[model samples]
Target: MDGGVFANLMHGFSVALQPSVLAYAFAGCVIGTLVGMLPGLGPLAGISLLLPATFGLNPIIAIVLLAGVYYGAMYGGSTTSILMRIPGEAASVMTCIDGYAMTQRGRAGPALAIAAIGSFVAGTLSVVALMFLAPTLASFALRFGPPEYTGLLLMGLFVLAYMSGGSMLKTLAMAAVGLLLGMIGIDAMSGYTRFSYDVIELADGIGIVPVAVGLFGLSEILLTAGQPTPPAIQRPTLRQLIPSLEEIKLSVGPISRGSLIGFLIGIIPGSAHIISSFVSYGIERRMSTHPERFGKGAIEGVAGPESANNSAATGAFVPMLALGIPTGPITAVMLAAIMVHGISPGPMLITQQPDLFWGFVASMYVGNVVLLILNLPLVGLFVYLLRIPYSYLYPAILCFCILGVYSVSNSVVDVWIMLGMGAFGYVLRKTGFEPAPIALGLILSPMLELSVRQSLAMSGGSYGIFFERPIAITMFAAAGVLILLGLKPLLFKRKDWREKVGLEDQV
Candidate 1:
């Protein structure tokens, strides 16, 4: 590494090692693991719920805590998937296929051990990659103009919709709805209110916090209320937690490949963790000497997907921190959190807020160590949490959600927005519509509109400016390809489209 990069990292460690920052990191890790173990509450909900509580803290400390929660949840998700056959998050869905099978065969210990170890390896490696790549990407992004940004945002939305494992048309429609909702407040250029209906609260755009908490947190409680409880789990002894030497030898290849695949895929805009896990599972199955062993009790299956999921989670931060563009719903929430702290995340973020940027990066390394310790020795405690009845759990979660949303601006209006959005989200869930694209669209819409308007103003209202810039042209071309690829199934009426997209028979 360069001396400057090394120097910044050393300074970051100095900040992250402070007593208060360590406490925050520890607290975030614990809360994240608990939330990840709970069904219907993933990183998105976990981060959104805690966002209001961070308003009183320093921006660096707040982000460090939130970032810890983000990856800590990734670790916890595997625990539920293995012990109870319940995926705590969508990215852990592949883990259920093999992780539970290993548990059934009395190999739960090795599976859990391999998962923690692989995640540690991937998480640490990805953080190193982030430290180097984010700075380089930010420098490159400084060259971008309004037209380039317009094309990039447009492509980002399209890529997210394309990769989202649902109906393309539905996802596109949801993005459109989000864009319209984003335009509700006063126009930035004309200083005129568009859709506020003269409500004073509507003078500013809808708050992202309430909308996120409502859609992902409150709505989840309502949706999961009717689901059957998870099955009982048997805890493994400490002796059983250690994997055999042969199993360790078998896992190294899959874990390494999974890390590389996940990190690369995560740099793209979409649900990369979910996609990466599926990809890792497929690669392991194909490369296995005895493919028939998969879905029956394969250690490689458990190791590969878990590692990919964690690595991809780390990779998702690259775009958000460097380019100020969120790749998925979770990163969008993080973007909002950073903005709420009066810090704009973009090319200048590293130079202007090196302490915040590098300190947050250093915290990830510390957080990974914390997660390994938590997952290895305390795995049994998390399993016990799953036994709690949903009847009692849902009510508590609802109360927390209400309080968190209400606390944002201390306004009942925000609470109502949350509840209204919760009902809407629940309805959308029942109708097979994914809420992720809508969230991404809502977050990116203002930036999209501003970039387009700015480009138009600079080009004398000409539509050809997008094509005139090489970078913009490249981004638009990529967007066109993604849109076409997303529509291929409908156009060709392919029966195996889901399989091709890695969504076939997924739980």
Candidate 2:
């Protein structure tokens, strides 16, 4: 690292290690872990809820706490995915396929350990990359016009659909539905409502929390409720929690590859963690010598996706800190937190507010270590949660889901929306439709629409603007390639796409 950058980082460490800052970081980590462990609650909700509390604090302290929550939640989400079939966050969904499979096969200890270890390594590495890359990348992103953003968002969605392990047609269809739903609120350019039905709540469009909670959390509950008793868990002893030499050897390559993939994707706008995890899982599956064992119980499956998710979380900070752009919902909240503290995050933030920028970066390194220490010993505790009877557990989960949705905006309308989505999700899943693509579509649709409208306005309604820009052309070409590759299965129909792609089989 440059001497100046190294000096700034050392100063940041000095600031972060203060008693008050350390206390806030520790508190944030604990609260974030608890929030992430619960279904329906994620970094978005956790940061939003605590945002009010940080109003009285200094910017650095507040950011330290909030940043801790952001990455800490990533760590906690893996525990739920591995112990139960539930993913605590959207990014953890890929982990569930092989993580729970490993649990069922009495390797839960190794899986959990690998996830924690891999997350630590990836998180730290991403922070290092973020420190060096953010300024350079931010400068490059200054050239991005609306046309470029439009292409980037479109490419991201296409890539997600292509990587999603199911029928590409079905995934694209779900994305279409999501786009329609995302259009329900008022149009930014026209200032006219599209699908609000004159309801005040609908004016802001649907809350992602409701949709995510309903589709993944409540639908899983309803599906599991209809099943037979869960299998008895094989609890591993303390010694077994540590991975064997051979298992570590198998995981190292995946961990390294996943970290790189995740950091690169995370710098893009939207929820890159979900895409990163899915992409990592796909890459690991393809690269494995025993590809057939992937969905069954592959250690690389658990390690790669988990590492990617955490690394992606760290990478998200680059845009928010360096460019004042919120990559996803969680960072959007963090942006709000910074603004509330009378600080605007942008290109000048590092120069004008060096302490806040570097201190936040330093806190990440501390938070990652804290999470590793916190999560390792608690692996057994989380696994023990799976022992509770479904009859008792499902009801509690239902209550928590309801509470979480309501808490988002204190709107009963949100709760109703969640329930409606839950029912829709259950039916959709029964029909072999995955909810993930719809969620992604919902999240990206508004941004895509706005970008398109802006691009057209800049081009005086001309269609040639997208192709004229080099970055836009590159992104569009990438999107086209992904779309064609995704459609290859439909064109050929040579095998069951689900089996060919290692999609999760219905339990």
Best by TM-score: 1
Top lDDT hit = 1
lDDT over C-alpha atoms for residue 188 of model 2: 86
State the lDDT at 324 in candidate 1.
88
Q: For each candidate in the order shown, give its overall lDDT on alpha carbons.
A: 0.85, 0.80
Candidate 1 — worst ten consecutive residues by lDDT sum?
496-505
Per-candidate TM equals 0.94, 0.84
In angstroms, how far off is 506's CA in candidate 2?
9.8
- Per-residue CA lDDT of model 2 for 43-148, tens digit only, reads 7656756766787899899989988888888898888888776777778888898999988887888998999999999999999999898867666877888898
lDDT for position 501 in model 2: 43
Task: Give lDDT tens digits, candidate 1, residues 1-507.
Answer: 235888989989999999999999998998888888776677877887788788788998898898888889989999989988877877888998889999999999999999999999999999999999999999999989999999988887787677666788898898888788788888888999888888778778787767877887777788778688766787877788999999999999989998998898888777788878988887788789987788888899999998998999999999889998887777877777788889988888988898898999999999999999999988887777878887877887788777777776777888898898899899999999977667767777888899999999999999899999899999999999988888777889875344653336543
